[model samples]
Target chain A: MSRPSTRPGLPRRGVLRLAAAAVALPAAAVLAGCVPADHAVTDPGPGPGGAAEGVEGRVTDARGRPVAGAFVEARGTGPRPNPVPEIAVFTDGDGRYRWFLPAGSYAITVTAEALGRRTLAVTVPHGRAVRLDFVLG
Target chain B: MKPFHAIAMASVLALWAAGAAASDRAVEAGVRGPVPGPSAGEAATAAGMPYAGSDAVSETELAASGVTLGTAPVGPLPAEMGGSEVILNWDSRMVLKTTLYPNRAVGLITRNGAHHCTGWLISRNTVATAGHCVHSGRGGTWYDRRTMRFYPGRDGASSPYGSCGVSRMHSVTGWTVNGNRDYDYGAMRLDCLVGNTVGWFGMYSHTAPLNEPAIITGYPGDKPQTQWISSDKVRQALTRQVRYRMDTVGGNSGSPVWSDRGEALATSGAWGYAIHTYGNAGAQYNGGTRIVSAVLNNYINWINRP
Candidate 1:
């Protein structure tokens, strides 16, 4: 038997169910290509709120291991009047790459010599750091 | 007069005529506004609109297509190394004064309403840039003109030369069709002739441009909408690419890889040799798509277009 819930608005089992749902929502979003598993609230780092937005992410291989030296190319595919910039950057030794981009939609492609390539579309909100991770096939 | 003396005089006149013709071509390429004297010979010939200058795959191409693809092997690249370093404010220089000649012509390119890249004016209306800046390639479509804009000499919030919407975009089959990295160059035709005011960069094909000073001025991703510059010498001049150790980051694609012809940035002497396209990635050098004769000819053709 579980102990009584500590001064809350639900039974112990109900609280557990709600907690499970909370934990599963992010994973479901990840599978749905909404955001990464860790995306909770967008982080707009310390600044005077500059016009440019940011995209920061890590690249990993199929086995979930960080893959360094991968080329991540982002092409702007827009909303109208304002399009995103075209950018191509490589992942660091820790398989991380980040860039500041103006707000807009982007078609991002990741290519690795050994593991191959993949493309995904993402929209960066204004003045926020959007996390976009990749898992190569 | 002796027959030898007559022949010598004729030969000297012939050499002068050839030199004059070459000079005219340089002027036509928009090297120095317009020479002080007569106009350059008739506009660049249109006979070579879509010439594939050379056949070489970029190091990135190996990954794009796992099948080791290329008509010829690319020449030696710079030493393999790490990615670009994060620069500190003291170590970096930002071009605050954007009204200067070549600086004014080098503009910031934006796709849709958000994406950014660097482009330099090559003609009254044509802006040269990286092919990837216009098209995704190897599984991507061309960027729509409705979403593109160019701001010459844009420093932060100031677009000193105003802005021009894209009328047309241009790229070669190697990039648009084949997705070849060595062919990663393209251009945009602006709706207005802004280059006339901001000035455009002159282009030339150097059979050997190695060791010539390479000054790349463009907007870097780290510093949004701000233009910065880096300098170095051409470390490796391949068949269709030029590698340099110049510091650069994302968003510098299509920046002019140019030389001031050792004339102290004379308005008449600067010429672009390549369109900066790639960062070092893991390689020891950053590189650009070299402007070969065929590429230069194609640019002339594009420039002359309506």
Candidate 2:
């Protein structure tokens, strides 16, 4: 909310008739707020080019035990200057998460509520899947 | 360059000032919500006598003065910081968006025929939104109140609590006149008692909640028929805004930025602190107009005014 470098946008010039999109997934189809069984615990597999680059890792608590349900996010430099978009996923029961992002630099922030605060910088090599783990207090 | 430039800014001030006078008199004449008719639609006409609402206003005034509906004060969606939205998952529950805090009343606000922004009900009939969402204070035109509609607790086509039209909209004169980003907050009077039905999030100001757990929920136009929620903490608390790195897209403008510290409030255990407006990509943070004393006082009077 720094002085918006830009002014408020105009209402659409004319009504741009847009087809309303309504795609209803199974209502509340989550268990204990963790991802579904398939996406959770199970590896979501990798994307196209083996060289496309990805990041996969496990989250653990102080004692080195898996920290399930931790909110993990990888924030990367985005196209625009104002809004920085990022890829966020929850660690599965095994406290593991894997997401393929265009090879680049990123800052990952983990919010586990009780674990205090932990932030780490990660990289998606030009076509390499990097493995990094977090040990939270 | 931004669409709202010097000339546009001046027009916003002049036109807004004129409308303010009419709005004041209209309110005194028992004109609760804006005149609701085809004439009061998005385009305000200069030549016309006003009608009354039920016997409510006619009982008070024989001939209501002509009230012109300004062209939509709120204009198009501003440039987005090029971001994507992420749905939340909690215990495999898909993080059902609306029920988590039904009374919080987070939903999409529609205006100017097709424009959309996010807002939340603060009173029985008053809603708080980004200043730009109610009127394009910076360089855009003011939206006709008749063209505004609020869908509280809206989940896709299903409006669990129902929808209502905007009656009167108000933004700080600083915003309307100076187009100051610091004053990027506004409120709208709804034509119906929707807040009483769906409940509203309580608003609090004058608190410095740096790093406080903050939650944002809104209907992102990117995901039509769906609402998204971001659970994060305040990264920076400024004089008039709070910054956070919450996943958001084009349609999240005017969203309520609230904290889960509602145990003290008799309503939903959430307190609204700001209205999400702008964000930065590399900076990785979104900024919202913090509900400071200035914003709070203006809104309290606007909502409580006759």
Candidate 3:
């Protein structure tokens, strides 16, 4: 494989140029082992204003079973005073809960009246479906 | 204008230095000695399946490539750039600049000539980037992968080590089903043990103040190149969106927004300016979904569980 280069301090544009060259130049010329998988493809999604949707998934226990009636809450990172609102839901029979929100930072909390609580933090981008599964003790 | 001029000059200098130092520290830290790698949950291992989609990759792939995810320790940036800016205000724990990764590594999967997105390791097998990088919403569908690979230590288009396939993936319900930007975060369970060469980052259990200086870092495109902005100031919004004065570009999506202390508070995604559509613009505005303590706690519990 081609050895990773560690030359720092290259200008931002310079780095970009180098990257372009790296991509265009023959992989065989630089390094032998490191090869770009022919499987790799690039599909830049639609530009801004595409208003991507959010993600949704279910939370379950250790036995591959859903945690019924568990309380599910959602929180996010933003500025203060107007920080992303924390939304909550209860798991249905299938241990599933869903919420629609804007694209941003987020954390999910699962709590049961008897089982305490657990939280998982994640980042959701525009037009994506992020799946977070919680396994309660 | 004397006092105003002095303040403006100070701010400008600070910003410049912060930007420079942020990148410097990230590169420096990446080269440092061994850091902790991601651990597998006993329950996950025993069950032979990860909670989310950690099973996307196999052990053979991870071993062949030596790919791992997580954070490295980054030193402080120059004093200017407001490295001490506070972004989240919780209880006693003040999330400072010393704790977060200003830059992040994102890996895009090319299968059947389509590129799906995922993030790189900062501290543990824990990788933080954009939620959209992995899953998507088109035709009322979610991009669920049965198999994929990750290149954590990729510097440019080359993987210094080998590449590993994903074992599992995780995201919040609101983010997946509701398109809620507020709760846009995800985690993955790797199939193999990421050695010390790759590490994970720390999280702020509490909160900090608003309008604190913060740094944002990430790989804009599939290339392993990264960028940093130090002197940027962010105003915490009541809506959980921390608005900041920083110039970001495309391919920067899924980057991490970190406190001066190196604690990741958010990840980059959507941009506020119209130039975002063209993928070329300077002095443009980009936003990241923040990592609140409540959500982080959930992730911790899931990852650490036996």
Model 1, position B197: C-alpha lDDT score: 47
In the range B138-177, model 3's lDDT, one tens digit per residue, is: 2223334334455543334444334555555555444544
Displacement of residue B169 (Cα, Å) in model 1 is 0.5
Among these predictions, the greatest DockQ belongs to: 2
Q: What is the docking quality class of candidate 3?
A: incorrect
lDDT of 2 by residue, B227-295 (tens): 777767888888777888765654577777876453332222345778887645235577788876546
Candidate 3 or 1, higher lDDT: 1
Model 2 gets an lDDT of 0.54
The candidate maximizing lDDT is: 1
CA shift at A88, candidate 2, in angstroms?
Answer: 22
**1 or 2, which is superior by TM-score?**
1
Best by TM-score: 1
* RMSD in Å for all candidates: 28.1, 21.9, 26.4
Question: Candidate order by TM-score, highest to lowest?
Answer: 1, 2, 3
- On DockQ, who's better, 2 or 3? 2
**DockQ-sorted candidate list, best first:** 2, 1, 3
Q: Stretches of candidate 3 above 4 Å error?
A: A1-137, B1-123, B137-140, B222-231, B260-284
